[model samples]
Target: MLAITRSLPLRIPTRLFSTTPISLSGHSKWSTIKHDKAKNDAEKNKIANKFSNAIAVATKLGGSDPSHNVRLATAIENAQKNNVLKKVIEQAIKRGAGIGSEKKNVDTALYEGVGPGGVSFVVESLTDNKTRTIGLVRSAFTKAGGSLSPTLYQFDRRGLIVIEKGELTFDDIFEKVIEVGAEDLEEIEGEDFIEIITDPSDTGKIADELKKEFTIKEVGISYIPKEDMLVDISDEDTKIKYDKFIAALEEISDVTDYYSNLKNEE
Candidate 1:
């Protein structure tokens, strides 16, 4: 169902790497309490693992003090929002600060892949082992009838900010975002939130300016797709495969964030 007029440049190795298979069954049965518990536990673990890495990365980038380091503050805020335990958050900070025996060198890497239905993926991961991380990523894509490839050409790197839509309408906020030098603004209907996109280098400064009036919810850089490169998956089979592909990625402990060129499903 996925059609490509031209051959996509592949980044996969000469031979496929092996990883433990991800059972799609874990996803198909969500009605029973037993299944629900398993899924909820997995989701919580994923959230905790991701925020732990994020906190560690932010602390290493700036300092552990949230007041002094905007990035660290954002990471901690997001962790707390997701209900990450206070002790886990503190431990991650200590590890990042090299103040604990658990401290280890952490590195961040980006991976590009083409998923089912020609959707391009950009995965950001923080890990101590690049070899193991790549192997898991590559296996996920392959098992989902996709492959690792050069998909960055189809996307642009940008900063994304989310803030409370408080008292202001979309027009009201658009004016403020433009005045703050953001590149674009989008209203999240029914969510009382607005998203502002900006040049990656300007994210922090713009966020600071906007924070004077708005409650900032999230601040981060993202890989956004070029208009012409967006993929739409209408076929049910391809959709199923894509969902499973995403689930597999979510189960990987090292992956922190992922981006895609898929259009919003209607």
Candidate 2:
């Protein structure tokens, strides 16, 4: 159960919005993916739909209160960024929390499989109709020269928390985060945030501890690659094929996330 803090302020930095645990939605899966998913009108609509499901799911899992419910808070933030109407987000919360007659049977489904060139994929979806979602997702994979699998040994589901790069230096964050049991702290040079990776089970607890000081930009369960596949850019054919394949998968309305193990080094 989630409890919303009624009197505290927890506004996050604006630049911290991207990816997920990849969190909120599918904003920050990879820098390449982000660049591929430029926000046109169609992309914005896709984001809106994804966020609606995310908000509903977060509320159902935690509760409707954004303050106490980390997932819902993240969902709300990402949803607003995608131009999802405030009233719509509130309605989603209501439906998710079963607050009124406006109820929805939303559930999350994950498909682990391999995509083109043996790239591992963990497609996460929030759907009201699992049958339809599965068919479309599988079809997308099949068309992309891939097949569904029961397990994703190539991927490890982990807890990823992203905090904005505030006044605190890397050393400052490392000292504090390591004390609280973070597995690793990642600082990408020229990035606006530092990412902390934690054990999946301890995510909520550690996030709470960090919130005592840091403004959390995103937090959630993420399908991180056990080993990232290095894609050589000289192979333009492979890149083009994968890009088309990913676009097809993302076109499926229910497929809110497209997490892959392949990392095309820019």
Candidate 3:
């Protein structure tokens, strides 16, 4: 799944999986929350375990060969990016492929909700405990000044590809992206991004085509904010309330990626 971050002062949470200090400029509060959670050994371990589980699921659906299975391949890439051991990735693929699980009962699910100031949120989970996961998500939304609903139509699921600005020209990438069926492209200060509006089916092909021209900084399917809400709270208050909301959401083990339309003042 490709996740897109518009120029809405929002950040994707990939930085949480790394050790580098997050930049204050262009920093997304959700990204900060992820980084903070990863700083704790216990939380980091939990996230790693979840990734392992996802790997297992992906491998099971498609054989362990990353070369042959794009989903499995991407999952392996993410696991490696987060420093998951090679053995763990391999093991997950084996398990997912049903080499070990005699009981096939696991089910994967995704949940969508609204967050603070009506920000859209999407949570992806691979669990045997669907009831618990949904309950936890619902509670988070209620506590965060939002609620759950079936109307996910407000947002569009799209393929997001991010690359360094220096790697390619905007026009060149834009032309190629459109040729490959991308919906739109945007240029930020030093990063170039492309959003491909695709049915769930065309995501992989678009991703593969773009990678041939640019180094993929991050790629995942994500719910993008249809329209953003700008809040004018004091910096201190923004930090407090926004951080609190994000912290609470990130703690939910079932919430994989959270997207919001809320923009923070730099």
Candidate 4:
């Protein structure tokens, strides 16, 4: 079913499946606490794994020297912000650079698909085994009522820099970024932050420049949807099913980051 909320379109599937129970009412304080904690745990793990993979790729591609390697430097900086422990970052570097006994082969991979509600998605990963990574990614898409495909036509590859607004005005950040190869600037309305977009290859360079002006929150290459679709999950049962589906997707370790065209209730 297709519906419109505000200016965005919502595509609902004809059939839905099993759902985990959840309370949407504000009255369920204890239930909300538990729910929030569980979500936090999921996000924490997801972020940690993503940085670990990024560190691996940076090391593998440009050696372990953060000073000399721009990608490694950015990866290290991003990891530290996510609270990835120093020891863990060092080990990931070692694993990628083959510097110690923990040496292992690792490489970045990506997969694209049409997820539930006709939303497109891209899955990024760093894996020692390509076959294993492919299998897990494909399985996630299938279980989400989606199918994996090679097409990424719905997305654009860009370097994204996330930074806090702090004391700087929008024009202040824009001026700095424009001089440093930024392609676009967007204020995340209502959120005290902004997103800077640049040529994928110029991300590291631009991020370094922005760091001098604002607190860098995140920097990386991503597949952003050219257009976004809002999925109406006003129905409690559908929201639960979607949440459970995403939780399952989050459980896959190799999936460093997954971009979706569907904007749904978290």
Candidate 5:
């Protein structure tokens, strides 16, 4: 699945899965509370893990000083906005900075694979063990009847920045981003944010300029497919495999983000 940072105004054309539960009759009050709490805790842990990896990556990429590292500053800002604890943030920084015995080596890893229906994918993970991460990724693909292959050539690497719309109009952000040399600017209908695509080298410069007047929701390099491949989800077998593949990828904690060429068509 393509990971979209902000909500778009356009309605989604496809329903991957039904979120509504089929039955809730078997639950007691305490059981419900326990289930809810567990879900919430799991969500919180996922957020923490993502931010921790991001912070560590930013620090490793440009050192521990946020003042000198735009990516680090952005990562820290995003983490704080997500309510990640101060101590956790600091620990992540230390891990990246390689401070003391508590520090662990972390690296960014990428895996290229195919999903159900010949959908090409580029999966990114921030992990301490490449072997373990690759194993998990390969298993996901194999389970879905897909396989790892050379797929990076099917996409382009670009810097994608998502900015909150706030009180600004589409023209408002569009004009500003154009002035900053953004490659593309888009405001989808029904979305409350603007997306700006820029050259990898200009991401920090554009993001820094926008921060003075806009709320930056996300700033990172993303893989965009050269073309969209429509996958036939109407077939029961295809749909089942698609769901299975997506679930497997989601379960891998190290998999931070993924990009795919699969298109959901009406």
Candidate 6:
């Protein structure tokens, strides 16, 4: 649920955003494949499934009503955007709302580790089988020349909110956010965003307030790198090795999200 933001100190090259698309260009090929793969991958569909599960969980925690249950409402909205079946979403809401005898068992787990080039990696997983998921996460890190830590203190947790450009002024957002207990706000690339640093206790309140103003892309606790790694792995062999390591980590079914301290160009 964490929104990972990478700082772009310099603008991406204009050539990178060419209007006329050409075949065989690196950007074109990668973009084409990325779009195709995202549509075809079963693992990607798991996101919708996860949202359904979240709806159930939220409904169970609060009531089944969206107006009363803010979390459940947000989860349902996200599920709809991802094209989740309406029936499934309704079933989840009912189950969560306590209309059924289904037992709810949603677990949120975090895994911290160091990957190749000593880059810090934080993985967020949602599952019922914690033992199995943790083992799989550990194995993936080990196979990728990395190891997991039982305790990771090198990262900070912060609330991240993203809004489209010109939607709201920073002052309006800031004043409303502080009332909900936000710590800081940041603006990125003409897009309005706010980073609320609240104690774990205040997260829910802050989320509810922000959702009233801007569409919530994602919401959850995140492990942010204290310092980022800027290694020069421009060579093909080294790039391939790092790419393999990342791919392996991403392949784990239980790992919903992964974050790293590595820069985009690295």
Best by lDDT: 1
Residue 92, candidate 2: Cα error in Å is 2.5
Model 4 vs truth, CA RMSD: 8.0
Candidate 5, run of 10 with poorest lDDT: 5-14
| Ten residues in sequence with the least summed lDDT for candidate 1 | 4-13
TM-score of each model, in listed order: 0.82, 0.78, 0.69, 0.74, 0.82, 0.67
lDDT of each: 0.78, 0.70, 0.61, 0.69, 0.76, 0.62
Q: What lDDT score goes with residue 115 in model 6?
A: 68
Tens digit per residue, CA lDDT, model 6, 1-266: 22343321111112122368566645676788897798667554555556665676667556788776566677787788777789889877765554554444645578888767666677776566899999988887788777996435656666444434356677887787678777665565334545555555566677777777676654544555554333345567656666777667555655556666665432
Residue-wise lDDT of candidate 2 within 1-266, one digit each (tens)?
Answer: 11111100122112224465434554555865656666555656666666776787778777788888886887788778766898888887886786776666777788877767776777888777899999998988898888897546766677778788799888988999999998887885588787788898888788888988888777777766554343233467777777777768757877656566666322
How many clashes in each candidate?
0, 4, 7, 0, 4, 0
Ten-residue stretch with the least lDDT total in model 4: 3-12
Q: How well is each residue in 153-220 modelled by candidate 1, as lDDT tens digits? A: 98888877778999987898989899989988887657888778889999988987887899887777
Residue 199, candidate 4: C-alpha displacement in angstroms: 0.6
Model 5 stretches astray by more than 4 angstroms? 1-32, 228-232, 264-266
Q: Could you give candidate 3's per-residue lDDT for residues 115-211 as a string of tens digits? A: 6645555566655578988898888778867788653565676755555555667787678778988777667543355444555566667767766
Clash pairs (backbone) in predicted model 3: 1-220, 1-221, 2-220, 2-221, 3-220, 60-96, 60-97
What's the lDDT for candidate 6?
0.62
What alpha-carbon RMSD in Å does predicted model 6 have with respect to the real structure? 7.6
Tell me the spans in candidate 2 whose CA falls farther than 4 Å from its real position.
1-40, 98-101, 228-234
